[model samples]
Target: MVLLHQLDFSYMFVAIILKQMTPEKVITITRFSVALSFCWPLPMTSSRNQIFGYKVAQMFSIVNVNLLLLPCFYAIYLRSDDIEIVAKCISQSICQIQSIAQTVTCFCKHDTLQRIVDELWTCIREAERYEKEIFRIYIARCGRFYGAYVAVAYTMTILYLWGPLFLPIMHVVYAEYPFDVNRTSMTAVVRAHQIIVSHQCCAHLCVCVFGAFLIWFTAARFECLGVEIQRCTDIRMLAVCIEKQLRLRRYAQDVISCFRFMILFVIMTCSLVMTLCAILIITKTSLLVEFMFLLVAFFFLLYLYMYAWPADHMKDMSLSVSRSVYELKWYDETVRMQKDLLNVLVCQSPLKLSINFLVPELSLRYYCTYVSNALSMCTALRAILDKTVA
Candidate 1:
């Protein structure tokens, strides 16, 4: 019965770890799918016809933007939830293990009990480090996402307020024709259409400008995170050199991955904005021209969502690998310390056991196991990052 209970507990632990890992993979895949779906052609037949094409295209653009972009936002929300869940699970696990170590201490020798205490303390510290890193990455990513939404909202507002003002202006601009010698006047319909199109062109320009600002802002923020991560890694390496157990390598890597993903999103967004700008500069006053620009903008917005979806996954993987690396390094240090202490104890040296207990056989073995796991996670994350770039 005791053996069965032990097995069951082990299974539960494994299950939790698996659950935490699964969400990272799922989030990455979903986000990528959302990004690719933006490139698909619109289904409206009227959008392609010269007479009614502009209105049809405009309607379809609205639909695509709402459908594609909204879901990407939803995906980010889900990923954030997953990160919080994993963090809580890790914290709880550490507490439980610590409690178990305390309970088992009464039956163990003084040296053995002390070693176990030290190891448990190390695990708690590593877990805390992991939690901190994950939280930081989450906040940064959220900031970029919020900034994007703000840009879109501002663009829509500009369009709504300015659209009506253009109707009269269009009538004035298109009313005078030099080549029509037989007729002395222009129709009210042509004038009104011209006014509306002119207003739309201005609106498109404003949206493009807003989008450019947002993308640039996001890119800059991501770059800052990259720099911070690099600093952290340097500090972590220094700690390692001093024989201190600190797990921060994975954190650094995650920062890099986040930056890469954000850059891709910004570049794509910038390209879309440039295309819209070019369309606006054309002197042609036809409705077809107006519709084409709106369609392109709508598709680009969908593409942005799709591009951003996988970002959470990449961030998660980076965090996991960093945590794993830190834990492994901590374990290795604990083992080394334990072995030195054991040596002192066996030699009947008059040295204090607490100070000498840094290295131990059990700790060394555990460190090896942890290191192996960390390496595996790192390798996996690296592969994912490569694929993302490709």
Candidate 2:
């Protein structure tokens, strides 16, 4: 009961702070995110993401973000045959890989990200006109939801790291380090290092989720802008609407470019993540608390799909805006007005959020396809890994 109460209090407190993330705070977080990514150097030799040879490779030293916890990982797992320890090491390695991928991706898409941020700030400035405004309310709600999700993920991760320190709080033996049992400098050093990397990873995850929220707000903002466009009476006002719409479209392009890799990741991995969690949930395990925490992690991971939703919404709304312009009384306008109206061409195709034209558009339909593919893969894996009872 005390644990639950403490969790609730922590959630509320964190959420309160998170909701206050204005555009400036978001940029600060983005910079913090970029900084964390640089902690681990990218391999310049990797042909996939690198420009040349592995020249950008980070040193295998403590200061490097990705390698910062190598000592702690080894110290904790050196002598342990525990499943939790092995799982932790594997998970952390995956995180390091993702951090590396993101760092490289960020480097490649730095300019696009800046433009997206500028466009996002422009929307936020308009949205924050007053709390009672619809856009204000929508974004605030999104911020709260984003905060709650991030809080849950961070709490689970923290508990995974520090649970062994306290008795009852750690219902199961999750991580048993092989370091000297005594409170030595090494122990303190390892613990502090774990805390730092954990927070940095959490920041990375937060940036990912916040990006989705930004997409959601962008969709809603475009919808509002579309509504304004439809309500325009004079040619001048209509022209203004057309310009804003075009700008929003350009912003959409920048966003798509900025998060192309994220889109790819969500499309490819969301189903696999859930499938793994489902398998774990079905399989017997002694670490009930740990498994429950895993569920929290899975829940957060699934939200990666949220990024696609708003984009699809924006695409639909953009299509609607284009169509709605046709419904306007353009017949009554003068020849110059008609020429201007004719000059503003509607996009025949919907706005597509995609990865450089691969994997099709980012939409629920494609998401379902990825999920179905994952389910099939999971089924095959289970068949291969688990023998028949007969």
Q: Top lDDT: which candidate number?
A: 2
Error in Å for residue 178 of model 1: 33
Highest TM-score among the candidates is held by which one?
2
Q: What is the alpha-carbon lDDT for the whole of candidate 1?
A: 0.34
lDDT score at residue 44, model 1, on the 0-100 scale: 28
What are the lDDT scores of the predictions, listed in order? Answer: 0.34, 0.59
The residue-by-residue lDDT of candidate 2 on 252-279, one tens digit each, is 7776676778657644445545565556
lDDT for each residue of candidate 1 in 1-390, tens digit (9 for 90 to 100): 533454455455434433344223322322232221221122222233542443344444344333323333443445444532332222222222222222222222223323332332343344344444444454344434433333343344344435456543221221223234243343444434443433333333232222222222233333333333333333344334223212222222322322232333333443544344343334333454445444544544443443343333333332332333333333334555545433422432111101123222112233345335544554565566567657
